[model samples]
Each structure stands twice: as C-alpha cells, then as structure tokens.
Target: MATFSSKTFNSALYLSFRPGYNADFYKMLYDYHMRNNGQFDTAVDVGTGTGQVACVLAEKFKHVHGVDASAIMLASAVQKPNIKYHVSNGEDLNMIPSSSVDVLTVAQALHWFDHPRLFSEVKRVLKPHGTFAAVGYSFVMLENHPRASKRVYCLGNEPDQLGTFWDNGRLIVQNLYRSIEVPLKNVERHYFPDESGSELPLMMENVTMNHFRNHIKTWSSYKNYSEKHPDRPDIVDKTVDAILEEENLKEEDEVTLIWPTVLILAENNA
Candidate 1:
C-alpha cells in the first residue's frame, strides 16, 4: 500500500495494465446483493485506486463514494458527478454517515486492510442487510503457453527476482483472499475458474507481449526491485525476453491471458 502511495509510483500505468472486471462480474455481485431485497441507493468503494470500480458503480447506484489513502492514486480517477472521491483509509471512513451505504465493495485491495477494523467500519456504515463484496485476481497465466507461464511465475516467485520485494499483503492476494473473513452473514465465495474448469469470461484476448511486459512493470514488486538494484538489468525485460525466446513469439504477437480471480460477498445483518 505504501509503495503505491509513493510519489514516483506510476498510477496511470498501473491503471492501464491492470485487468478490469467485466460486466458479468458486476452482474454476479449485483445479483447476490439483490437476492435479499438489497437497495441500490448508495455504494462505497474502499481502497478505490484510480476509481476504477467506483466509476462503474456510479452507473448503477444513485451515489458512489471512492475512498483511498493515496491522493496520488486518486488524482487519476475519472471525474464523475455522482462519484465522490475521499482521501481516507478503508479502516476509517469517518466521512460517510453510519447505516447509509447500501453496498460496499473493495476491489483488489482487501488484503492490504486491517481486517478487523475494516469489518467494523463495514458494519457501522452499511445498512441492515446491505451487501459487502471483495474481489481480487491472482497470478496470471498465458493461454496455451505453459513454458512462458512457468517463466512468468518464476519472475514473481523466485527469491532472486522481484519476489522478496513484495509486501506481506501480496501473499493474501496470491491466496485469493481465502484467509479473509467478512464477519457478516450470508457470506459467499466465488472463484472465476470453478472446479469444473470453466474459466471466467474475464480473460484478456489478443494482448501483445509488449503489453504484458509493461504490465509486469506496473507491479509494486517491480518498482521496489528496480529502486534497490538500479545498476542491474531490467528483470521484467529479461523475463519477457525469456518468455518470447521459449515460446518463439515476437513482441508484437498477441496472446490470451487468464487471471484466476475470486469474489467474496457478505451481508450486514446487523
């Protein structure tokens, strides 16, 4: 979280490279929230870096609030009349009135939160039976390129590479937030690639290898590693080169990428 808050972190690049949730994902969340007669008056997006999720929620909810600790990250957020951006942490949303929000969501950021405090704030701000959703995607793999996928994994997990540079919160993200408990009722966990091996429709198709390279550069681990080893060769370029060599693909070659994503939803019964 601190890494992203840094002045030098490229929030725009991060926004461009990060995979986005599709309409189906929101449909699933909205369907779950509405299952118990949930309203769509107001929604709060905590840790809403660049307002990606908040911008989308604005189309559905009457009003939306995007809260983030990093003003730099929020600076890139899309300006929407219905969406209010707040410089606040997920654990303490004092600006929002209690028992007001109909839906609260955290996208790719629940792992960085103080779970107990965040859950308390979630309960305090959410109306009775309001919905809470947390969504995240884990390691990405190149479709039909097993060798390249393995190399990419090594780039992220090997101790000698960017692995050691990642914060402890990275593990929670890698684990797909399994360790997180919403401390609310009717909690549901959903996986993109279900046990039957059907992947979610969230796959990015026809993405260039160069795009993948830049995507790796947007990682916080990559930033930290680069800062600590300024003289060393760019590990991201090296990894991408290795993948291209092993797969016999050019930088312009397009490929499909799949991210194993997870979504957790709960209801504020209190």
Candidate 2:
C-alpha cells in the first residue's frame, strides 16, 4: 500500500497530532554522532514533515536541508532561517550534490520511501564515512492504558506504525549484547514491538474526554474514517467514549501510553 507521509493528507494530519521527539532521543543522536567522530557539517532530513526534526538539525549544522515531495511541507519548513527546504522526492537526488551531506536522517517517514532507490541516493549524497540514520516513534496505547490491549488491532493498523517504533534504547542494548560482541568497536557508533503486555508502567498522559477527542484529530485512521463516514457520526468519539465508559477514566485520569523508537545508522554501503 502507498504511504500517507508526504505533506498532503499525511503531513496535515501529522503536524496536527504527532508528538515531537523526546530530549532523551535527541541526546542519543548527538552522542552517537560525537562518539563516531561524525560532525554535522551538512545535514538533510528527508520527508521533513512539518519540519519538526528539521528544526533540531538546524541547531547542529551551518544550515540544514529539509526535503519532501510535498510543497506544503517544504513551505512550512522554509520558515526556519537556517534550515533550507526543498520539494524533491528522495527517489531523485539530482538536486543534491554528490558527497555533499555529512549526516542524512529520516524521522518517522522511512517506510514510505522506495528504499532501494532511497538507499542508493543516500550512498551517492553521503561522503565516505558519512552516517545515514533513520528513526521513528509511536504511541504506546497499551503502555498508556492497560485496557488498550483490547484495541491492539487499531494500533497495529495505523498508517504510520512503521518498524514497530517503540523501544526504550536500553532494550536495544540488551538485544545487541545477546546477539553480537559487547563493546563492539571499530568504526563504531555507525549503526543502529507492537505489543503491550502486562503490568508495564504507563506512559501516562493527562486525558479527559475532550482531550482525548482532540487527540482523535491527530489520528490518521480517525481523519480518514471521518472523511469516509462524515454522515456516520463520530466513530472516534464513540471509540473514546467506549474506552472511557469501560475503563471509568475520569477527567483527572492519566493513562499510560507506550512509545518506542527504532534508530538505524549505517555508513554508506556503496
């Protein structure tokens, strides 16, 4: 299936609802780059929806480039003075000079790309030893609410539920330790769950019915469903109501939501 990550329907919904990356996550990226002796001389964020991550890149580089297929998204990103924005799909990197980018990253928008095409272009644009990374994040509904298990399918089928984007980073360390050599050095720092199981601490959020309703607008499923079923009454509201009624979630209630992110980094494999 095609993806909704471009600036139009996907981006409109994303900017309206998607949460920004956490400082912890941001620090990890910086630390990785620094550890690897990588510098952000020139950076690009592909599929720069609403420019959220691009804004962060601006702080590191002399100037950052944000590119997307959607002009609307580029326009939004253009508002950043140090961040140049372009409306070019990743499949065609002709606009970007070869070996010009030091760090190339994609956030929450990787699955939408034609990966073979994108990977090839990334190799072309990145200088030797340059790092390419992709990171994604997702809501932890089950972590957010114990009762959310009943709605696992809803969460799984989300248009943007790419890469099971929910890991605590520490868990990644654990898995790597199990599989590969520890303290695995050598050109290091160059690399690198849809389930809500029992008794996990809630990634809680302050939520009332209205607050939850507002969040509905942030959901692509809710947005698409609304467009298809405008006369069908508000299914999102009904879903929220059902959850609230069943869980007895009151105005003062906060529910835990799970959010996991997967970060992948590799030297250009050309």
Candidate 3:
C-alpha cells in the first residue's frame, strides 16, 4: 500500500470538496448481501476516508466500523451512533474479530491498498458469503456546456501539471480497476439502487461553479501540484477563471455534473 503524506492530503479541503456517495449507492451495498440471504448486521468500511461510506452503512447495519490509515482524515469523519472510526492499515485489520463482519466496503480508496493482503484481511473478518465492494467514480463531467466540459476533462486526462502529480493508484481507477487483479471470487461491477432497491437515474443539476471548482481542487493530483509548485499557486485560480471565461459563466451559474461510479462486488465464499 502507498503511504499518503498528511502534508499532501488536506483533510479539511477534501471533506469540503469531495462529493458524498448518495443514498442510492448505500442502498445497493446494503442490498447486495441481503439479496443473497447473507447477514446484514455488521459492516467494516476499510479505508473509510472521512467515514462517508461507513456512516451510510450505519443506517442498515447494527454496527459500522470505519478504519483508515491517516489520523488527519479520520479526524474529519463525522461522529454518529452505531458507527466507530479507527486508525489502521487496510492490510492489517486485527482490531476486528474474525468472521464477524457481514459486509466490507472500501470506497474510493481501494486503489491505494495492497489488494492481496487487504482481500485476505477482508476474508478473515467477513462471514461466509459476506459482500465486499470497492467503489470508484470516473472524472467529474459537466453537462449543458461543451467547451467548459472539454476543458475540465482535458485538465484531468491530458499530460499537464495535474497529470504529472497523479500517482500509480490513480491509473487503476482510471482503468476502472480492470487491470487490477482481485483475489476474491465471483466479482462483478454493481450499480447504485434507490431506497426501494430499484435503479435510480444518475443525475445532478444546478451545481454552482464555485462548488465545481472546489471539487477539482480536492483532487490528490491537483493538491500535489500545489505543494510542489507553490510558486505557481495561481494554477487553481487561473484554471477556474479560464473555465468561467470560456463558458461565459458567472461564478454562481448553475452547471450540471455527472460522476459515473463503479463498484467491484465480490463474495467471501468462506
């Protein structure tokens, strides 16, 4: 697993800028196990950055334990009943009891883990046939505008400062985890479902440019660029400005963004 520098990862800005996984995403996770007649009482959210996925699991599971490597990131996680946050590496989940977890989830952070060791730990903690999901989302896309959308896509995709700052883990996500080997059996991609367990139309609308800019600024690559090129501190500002000018948009102008999420679902089969 790659070690993240607290200096590079700004937990405060990350909590503020990163989009939260919606209820639909949680519903799919909860139902994945239940639909298979597996238990749904306890869940362990590995690499539970800011406790987003763990908090969601708390609604369905009797207990939800969130474990992360960074203390700074865990500090930003919200406190809630039925939810506990712990500082631990994904590969070593010795704090959790064996065959005790009903569901194990790693949201947006699986790419950073030592997959084989993490899978072994997950299997140790999960009951037979327990669900394991690794969730990731594609680059944020802007709707209702072509020029601005293309520019944002280019910023994330093309070899620029942001591109150079991205770590190897990012490549796995960009490939939708296709290249990464999964040690678990019967793994497949799962989609988000509404509260009723039906597919929900994935959509977002009326997002302010400020909010969009904030999301871009939260990218690890962008943050890394900011740290290395402190002298070129205006890159973020200048980038956002260019988008606004090119799109003839005001700061408050509402734009639509679509973040297509992918999930790698598997069963413990213990």
- Local distance difference test, each candidate: 0.89, 0.60, 0.78
Q: Highest TM-score: give the candidate number.
A: 1
Give TM-scores for every candidate, taking all chains together and pairing residue i with residue i: 0.97, 0.73, 0.90
Q: For candidate 2, lDDT tens digit of each residue in 34-102?
A: 666777788988988678888888888887888887775554453667887887887777878998888
Can you tell me which runs of candidate 1 are displaced by over 4 Å?
198-205
Put the candidates in lDDT order, highest first.
1, 3, 2
1 or 3: which has the higher TM-score? 1
Q: Name the candidate that leads on lDDT.
A: 1
- All predictions: root-mean-square deviation over Cα? 1.2, 7.0, 3.5
**Model 1 TM-score, all chains together:** 0.97
lDDT tens per residue, model 3, 1-270: 232437447777778777877666666666777777887689999888788778777877899999998888888897889998888999999989999998999888878878788888988999988888888776777766777777777787777647767766887877667766777778877543234656443434457999888888878777667777888756667778998988888889888787655777888869
- Give candidate 3 misplaced runs (Cα > 4 Å): 1-4, 191-206
